[model samples]
Target: MGEVDIFKIMKEAEKRKKIKEKPILVKKVEIKEILPCLTTPGYIRFTAQADREIADVIPIIFLMFPPGKTNYSVKENTLTLRAFNRMITFFPNGKIAVTNTRDKQEAEEILQKIIDIINEAYRSYLKYGKPSKETIEAAAKLSWMDIYNSLPKTNCGECGYQTCSAFAVSLLQGETKLSKCKPLKGEYFKNLERLKQKIGEIMLNTLGWE
Candidate 1:
């Protein structure tokens, strides 16, 4: 008879346990298109496709869209918004388009993060006939136009920008604050406050922070 080698057996069991507990990294995503950004210099656009069917998630995304930075069209079955400083569009065919990425590496990273959300939404839909509201709300964020429209439109240069649109873009980039808009008041201030809240919520939701 041979020795049992109990230590080796235990080590093997522990390795298997750790492997089982580790999350499975998604590998079924493919980057479909990579293009230069026409509107924004030094940025690129990436279009990606997931192997699994995600048509079921489009409507849930539309329903849970957060205010300000998000736009959803039920007729088109599409949702367009900003996330991680990139413009993203969720389509009905399990495909997504993200613009304004810094580079291919950054685009890939963003797609992975996006795929994580998609997987969560798909799983939720399969199990409960609905996607998680938190996931959808976290994924969608405000665009520059969304923020600009809510500003005073004074172009007062109090925010150190030649135009309110430029200031709105800066706010999205975290380069400035709403407080810098000295002339902002009344309804514009109220809108600005609400947009800020939404942006904060999205940051917390996506970054896994409280």
Candidate 2:
């Protein structure tokens, strides 16, 4: 008999678990805005408003994040965080702003995720005051200009992008890699490596890594 497909079985089981899990019902939430992402064409800026007052939770969100991984202004009561491809900003007035989301479903999923994180942050704050500031630096947000500036700028079609700026946007979206740029060599290649490292650090921080 062929070996049992344990990996496939586990994946199926996980899928079933997801199906069984109840969806988060964000009450009175509406998409307030949708705009094109400035860094990446076709990506979107999505904003939503919720019925509940979340101002009290902004501090908790700040307390949960490691210092350099997020941008929080206590005076303003706002917390800005990056999660995956989305840039999330929490406002004091129960409104949330999200950027770089691909579609409505993704925006909704990110909203649910932000709610869960905020709740967790509140609980942690109740117990631990605030997370200690760490020296391990991370990017709070990525910019296309940063990527574009680091790229070879040869505008070669080797990466299947028409322009270097297009490739940079794709890099920010995780659609392409520096190694794919045929013209990138020597100092330009080193710059790509550095950009890649920066991106990796940002990705890890987004996952709540300290």
Candidate 3:
């Protein structure tokens, strides 16, 4: 019998379901303000508003990624993170501020991505119960530790990183590709397989990738 390609199976199932998925989205978003962002010097900030409040989904959406290099405030219902080389801040009242973007079109595109993510989280919340405070906190504790442990650990610079630890950090941040680590092709090939499953080839393929 031929072996089952689990990743392919899962991807197909998700694609089939995605066709029927209908998510409630903010009706309209208008960019009402444009301000200079000191962070990127020449770059600017895009301030926009959604049609409805997104307070409930803010925390749920934040769970989409690890807490590394991100800031969140429960009281204020806000999240700040990096994506598309821009700094994005999500507010509970459906306000969005994207910084470090020089063009209006790019800002609008980024806003759409954020809306897609928000809708994704809303769907998850509908299917599964809201994530607990404990679950959110635990996910934050997931640092470069597990990812670092899964590396070749040879401190090789072949991956354009000074050390394997650096490469692991980049991997967690989705800054670099898994194929960049050369040693994994050698005796540490097992590490490659392990990393693939850990990182979830199927999950990443289906998720809203930044």
Question: Relative to the true structure, how large is the alpha-carbon lDDT of every model?
Answer: 0.65, 0.65, 0.70
Estimated TM-score for each candidate: 0.50, 0.48, 0.62
Q: Number of clashing pairs, model 1? A: 2
Instruction: Supply every candidate's count of residue pairs whose N, Cα or C atoms clash at under 3 angstroms.
Output: 2, 0, 0
Write model 3 residue lDDT over 95-161, tens digit each, in one string.
8888888778878887778777778777777765576665555444546777677678888789899
Query: How many Å off is the CA of 132 in candidate 3?
Result: 0.8
In candidate 2, which residue ranges exceed 4 Å CA deviation? Answer: 1-28, 125-210
List, residue by residue over 35-125, the lDDT tens digit for candidate 2: 8888778988978887777766676565444333467665576788766656788888878888888888888777777777766655554
lDDT by residue for model 1 (43-143), tens: 89878987765567765544333334557664576878666776789887768888888888988788878876665555545555654444344335456
Candidate 1 stretches with Cα past 4 Å from truth are 1-27, 63-65, 131-210
Candidate with better TM-score, 1 vs 3: 3
Candidate that would win on TM-score: 3
The pairs that clash in candidate 1 are: 69-142, 69-143
